[model samples]
Target: MTLHRFKTCATSFLAPFILAGVLAGVLAGLSACSGNEGANYEYDYPTVSSDKFQRQRLEELEGGDETVFGELSIGGPKKRGGAAAGEGFATVNYYLWRATLETLSLGPLESADPFGGVIITDWFTLEEEPGSQYRVTAYILGRQLRTDNIKIALYVRPKGTGKAKMDPHRASAVAEAKLENVILSKARTIRATQFK
Candidate 1:
């Protein structure tokens, strides 16, 4: 029974990793198949468009419905969700990302991950409001500069000298809302100034 349980646990733990490896192998095979145009010693296959009889036959069979206008694409069709083979996957709005950094300049930045769209600020206290300390964390979810795509979290605690139980960092909705407004406003201003 113990051996069986261990087998089950081990299988469950490693199943996801094995599946991921298989997926990566398949994707690599697909990408390798797409770049064959540059391969050396490759045989040139004839398409229907290259042959006179086949092109005329195909046109007659399809009744000219297959005639595609504009530039012909050799690559996969463009669609939403997921990146193509060569395009970089950048989902965060640059305006909101820059604005978050600028708005949180009052506090020392702890960590910023551009690709992950996360910004964490160290705890800081304003000279004007010494009674409270604030820490800010911002998340930019997508490429769009919409209010719903950005989130701000503000933690506040009383400025205490010694370790105090009551002065623990508490999440403040009001502070978060205010910070969100400020960040969005700054992002809009930056977008207007830069894009114009």
Candidate 2:
């Protein structure tokens, strides 16, 4: 083929590819700009308490005293319930701790598997009130709550020197291997009978 004809054909074919590349570059630029705007969107959630409980939770987590095995922390429950059918109503106490991903080498918990990010908690105080700030800790459940992006579920149990007992089922949520109950409350407590 003559040089002129060959050149014409190549230019025509390359035009579309070049145009596509330019279009893609423009789209990527716009996409990045849009994402930056996302940072400007404010989030609204209940304000995290500045109380000692919250402070202690962050302090222990940041102090590097513990490590999470997967998606767990060793503390007490964040949610509470009334007494069970057979058991009398009891007031549950909780203490929380926090840790950073770089420190614990843990990842996001909500992604299919939470236990992947675990932190072994240290004994912190659960203040039921004056003289009642008992020492305790446990495995915590971690999930990226949209606002803070890092939230851990405290699975509390009886700690050193504390006679107060947590429902067996609540304890199992942390101890069991297979996920028997996604909702922590629904799982049958190991029951006082199992302990005996």
Candidate 3:
């Protein structure tokens, strides 16, 4: 009787383990039969193609004209006096159509994050002429978020031909004007659409 009770207790204890092993095998077989080799792949973020963005921007500026040019650049600031090596900032510049580059719309700068990037959503109308080109320089300021009084300047010129012969100050002014014109025009369009 003693032997029989011991055997029964052992069987009960082993029963759960045996059941778990059987379930695991069954699951493995089902997974194999389902043709799932555990080769799941995923991309976390939306893949933003430079070409795609440029094309989209150009299309917006061209009013669906279907003829447009788009270019983009991204890189760090040039090294200056030997403060720290490999510590610099970079910017992504975008130029769409053939509008001249002018102003940068830099967002607020915080002490904790002293420097910020700008996105220039530029819109303008120009007379149809050859070699008419526009450049939009997206300036990026690199600041030390923590230690040291380090600041770096980085810029990327949107892809285009021709040149706007203006000094930095004048270029900024022109850009601001263009931006204003774009905003005003867009607002007018919206108003007209609403009223109509």
Candidate 4:
């Protein structure tokens, strides 16, 4: 009974303030909604003349008619097939370099030079050719992902021999050519995946 009496007295004392707050809120909302949108209004800032740089920028923005990155011209898209801003121009073939590294992963990597496009592998023997340990040195000659721009040299050391030379039987010139072909195939695959 005491709690009920306290709640009733408190609500009665706060009723006038709550009603005034609700009345103020309703009036504010009605006034806001009754804006004079029919009244004409204009920006008061003075117009400024465009300089040469401003005109050039406006022209560039307006002249984006080329369809790029498979997107509409109105929206910005990635520029294809070139170095982006702040990046140095690429001189070596990227796909060829990646493909050579991937194909030579059979052996332990000794050295890899991306700019110079040189890949070398340490002497390692495959399971099929346990008697012959092989080393690979690949050179990407140009900025093209073509077969002629890439070169591969394979050296084989037979079991019990201290020095290593081009393989006589296992990894000969034929094997070198085959290695180049493998790298080329991998490059093509990598290029395909990138496009997709």
> Residue-wise lDDT of candidate 4 within 44-163, one digit each (tens)?
997666797688644433332112212322223424344552133224566777788889999999998765668899988899978878889998876556778689989878855544
Candidate 2 worst ten-residue window by lDDT: 88-97
Compose the digit string of candidate 1's lDDT tens values, residues 10-57.
999999999999999999999888886866896889755458876775
- Residue 48 deviation, candidate 2, in Å? 4.7
* Local distance difference test, candidate 4: 0.71
Question: Sorted by TM-score, highest first, which candidate order results?
Answer: 1, 4, 3, 2
Better of 1 and 4 by TM-score: 1
Model 2, 49-89: lDDT tens per residue?
Answer: 67977788655434322322321333322232343311321
- TM-score per candidate, in order? 0.53, 0.20, 0.22, 0.51
Model 3: per-residue Cα lDDT over 1-196, one tens digit each: 6999999999999999999999999999888787756779877997889999988755443332111111221223334346642243332111211111222232222122112333333322234423332334332232211111121222223334445323222244555445545533443344345324
Q: For model 3, which pairs clash? A: 99-134, 100-134, 101-135, 102-175, 103-175
TM-score winner? 1
Alpha-carbon lDDT, every model? 0.71, 0.36, 0.37, 0.71
Measured over all alpha carbons after superposition, the RMSD of each candidate to the real structure, in angstroms, is: 21.0, 19.3, 19.2, 12.5
Off by over 4 Å in 4: 1-90, 161-171
Residue 58, candidate 4: how far off, in angstroms?
28
